[model samples]
Target: FDLVELHRSNRATPPGIVLDPFAERALSPADRGGDRREPPDETSGATASRGGSGARHDRLVALDCSWETAERLVEDFAGVHRSLPFLVAGNPVSYGTPFRLNTVEAFAGALCILGERDSAERLLSKFTWGHTFLELNEEPLARYADCADSTEVLAVQDDYLAEE
Candidate 1:
């Protein structure tokens, strides 16, 4: 995972799908046409877990700043930006809170929705509380993963929120 310190360089370009709430575009499997490219086989490892179509050469970018500053900072990078579907945060700081993921959690959630389960698991393994996030949001994450577009994602989110 290449961590780009947004404060360090103004020239840094986001590698792949960016997890930005302020993004105008939504990352969806159908948005890229059909999955014409072959996804990496199970034994291929991390490199095979690139989200979205294999055509794009980039990595998933998650801003690590405070939420107050995230909106502004996210505008600085350019790429395919996507907003995460509604789910609860599992980190101690905001346990049970909805839509407030730390960097690792955000990455994992985004990866899972993008059908990169192995990659998501790999990222979550870096943090002790990672598994908790998966457990807490298992249903929402599964629903979000099945969505073909952002509209479907939003619908799922709405249904989940309404249930609360």
Candidate 2:
């Protein structure tokens, strides 16, 4: 599918962009920092409003669901936004977290959106927060090693570890 250029422009790429673990790139011992996912904080642009521009912040709907649920979201996005691109952001647990109130009908609705199924898959594939958590906890010594340079590591140890 030819990407809608405007929609493509509106995409908010996940902050910590990382290559898939099983992707073509060769794994290196230096994979720690590369795989860590940091929590989202206020963006620089958001903090720079010295004066009001009168532009309202867009609404973001956060939810938990599975692949089926994601498909439904795509449908809604396309239906509501036939021209403009809408951004959808969520962690993997947003889907299939049974404790939440989601419905199969909603999932089906998402799938009904033409071409949205692929978009949903791509969205899920690009989001790696869940994967980052797994790598960090499961391999304590190696997580974030990919991101830490020698100076940063020293600073971290001195500042954070010294008290411990």
For lDDT, the strongest prediction is: 1
Q: What tens-digit string does per-residue lDDT give for candidate 1 at 1-164?
A: 44223333324443345677665545554433223342321110012226344443345656667999887676565445567778789999999988788877887887778777777788787778889999999998888888888888888888988997
TM-score (C-alpha) between model 1 and the true structure:
0.77
TM-score of model number 2 = 0.18
Q: Cα lDDT for residue 102, model 2? A: 28
How does candidate 2 score on lDDT? 0.24
lDDT for each candidate structure: 0.65, 0.24
Cα TM-score per model: 0.77, 0.18
